[model samples]
Target: MSLFLIAGIALTGFLAAGLGTMVGLGGGVFVVPILAVVLGVELKAAIAASAVCVVLNSLRGSSVYLQRGLVNVKLAMVLQVSTAVAAIVGGLIVIFAPVQILKLLFAATLALTIGVMIARPNGGKRVKSGPDPYGLRASFDRPDDRGPAEYVPQHVRSGIGLSSVAGLTSGMLGIGGGAVQVPIMNTVMAVPLRAAVATSTFMVGITATVSALIYAGAGLVDVAVTVPAMAGIVVGAQMGGQLGSHVPVKMLRTLLIAVLLGLTIAMAADGLGFL
Candidate 1:
């Protein structure tokens, strides 16, 4: 592409990475839409590029969260197992399944999630004061808190089940699964939103790495497009990570809800051939 086009793509990556890291969406959600719709790139190529950006964005963002003790490594590892396996299943299903139908289903799922989240906006931050059976409990200091907040991850089996679905969608859609993972971790699993976001940041890196490899193997990755975008994502992720560490939890929650709403609309439109 031309230098001007390269510059524009890098700028897009910067903005996407910043927001994605802040809300734990791994940047793929924004990058895919911008690349495919606004920039007029082919859909598969855009997804491939987005997968690469998310990998780098998550890695960089996770490092910051880890340093601040916000990431729940144990919980992330446990969920990764399910997501990783389901991604392969999703890849295989693409051969026989109609993508439009899948999109509609995914959109419906997001809509339902949004309703649940709105109805129970404060449900995920509860800290259980008893023994933890799953050993997935963790604690972290919030930006606005006077002390650390402790929370045990509940409903792990259910979280695993949902994560598998997230991974399947990730594979089928060629995007990182962080959007679904964040809500499931926070809402269904009773993880604190900050920790859930941090953990999701870490988790998406591994999942995106797997996805990027698949795209690379398929010759869908465009190095020329990826290099510039990755450079921007790297810097933006650092900025986002720093901001995330200090941002108020209420603002973060609001932003996450808005993002889900937007994604719901986008997926529904795509399913209906309106986008």
Candidate 2:
């Protein structure tokens, strides 16, 4: 690649990483769009690159969270398996899907993100919290040093079921599972929001790995486009994620939603050959 191209991709990765860090997200959301627009790559190619980027970014952040005792390892592992399986299936669908369909899905996902953010649902009844029946129970250290406590999920079955859906979304949409997982775990499973976010990052790497392997085996993985983008996103995301807090998150989120809507309409038009 030319020097300019290399720098451009690096910039993208940098932004992704920075922003991801700011928002406690893995930052994969920005990768595909950046690759598509900047490198002029096809959607599938961009998605694949974004998937691999997520894997690496997760690994990077996971170790830190693990050290801090933030990751709920056992809980994350169980979810990972379900999420990975779902993602593998989703990734294949993306490979064959029309751009218009993918765009609509992206827009819809962003809309979902916005809705959840606005709701910030915290009040809910825990169906079963004291006695864990689902064998899929665990614990972790909270950031505030509130003393270590074991977590018995009230929505154990539903959590797994939603994970399956999140996995599918991740694969098809080239997103980290956290976008959906974090909210559900917090609102339904009663997992604390920060812990949920951290654990979701832990699981995202696994989901991305599964789908990436499948894509690689199918000869659809394009390192030429992916590597530079990853380099840029990983670096940029950390900063962006940190910056996420300083700004009004709702405003930023709404802006992102608007972009998502425009992209969706554009893609729909493209599919209808109206653009």
Candidate 3:
């Protein structure tokens, strides 16, 4: 590829990672579609490159959240187990799955994420004095004047079940599983949104790491594409992690929904050969 094209790809990675880090979707969601659709790269190659960048985005994003005490390490660790196992299955499937199927799955998942985000518009509600439900308690400083937010994760079993699905998609689609995890954590588990996002960021790094290794082992990863994207994501994720702490929760949710909606349409079209 020309240096100019490489620069453009890096810029795309930068924007994708920044938004993904801020919203906990993982940068691969944007990177995969952009590469496959706009840049006309093959679908599998795009997915492989996205898997690589997502690992960097999650690692860099998680560090900031960890420092700010937004991450629930225990929660993230518990979730990672199921995700890791599922990722292996997903990775194996990716080698044989049809390109059209993968593209449709990506669009379907994005639509699901949008529906979940809209269903539970309110988040970051303060916890009331009560008995421990699931024994996974998390707390973080509120970005608003609502004081510190504390909440116990309500449904451990459900979170694990849903997170496995997230991991499977992460491996197959190279989106890092955060798009699914955030909604499951915030809405289903009752963890605060900010905490959910942080935990998702931390969890995705592990999930993506497994997926990346699988893709690399299969020789699906393209260095010419992955190198620029990874470099951009490493920097953009740090910027996003800092910015996320200050941005309004409502604005973040809105942006996520809007972006997903557009991507859903584009990817679905691309999958059907309409793009």
Question: Evaluated with lDDT, which candidate comes out highest?
Answer: 3
Which segments of candidate 1 are over 4 A away from where they belong?
A: 19-25, 92-120, 142-145, 238-275
* Candidate number with greatest TM-score: 2
Give the count of colliding residue pairs in each prediction: 0, 30, 0
Query: lDDT of all the models against the reference?
Result: 0.74, 0.72, 0.82
Q: Estimate, for each residue in 11-128, the C-alpha lDDT of model 2 and write its tens digit.
A: 7667656755554555566666655644656777777878888888788878888887777787887677788889978988887777767766765665676566566678334333
Worst 10 residues of 2 by lDDT: 123-132
If ranked by TM-score, best first, what sequence of candidates would result? 2, 3, 1
TM-score of 3: 0.84
Cα TM-score per model: 0.77, 0.85, 0.84
Q: How well does model 2 score by local distance difference test?
A: 0.72
Cα lDDT for residue 1, candidate 2:
58
Q: Write the per-residue lDDT of candidate 3 for residues 67-172, one digit (tens) a residue.
A: 9999999888888899999998898888888888888988998787788768755553545446775556767777786887777777678888889999999989
Among all windows of 10 consecutive residues in model 3, the one with the lowest summed lDDT is 120-129
Q: Write the per-residue lDDT of candidate 1 for residues 7-79, one digit (tens) a residue.
A: 8778878877776667555666666656655676655666677778777767766888999999999998999
Instruction: Give model 1's clash tally.
Output: 0
> Which runs in model 3 stand beyond 4 Å of their true positions?
19-24, 117-120, 124-135, 141-149, 238-262
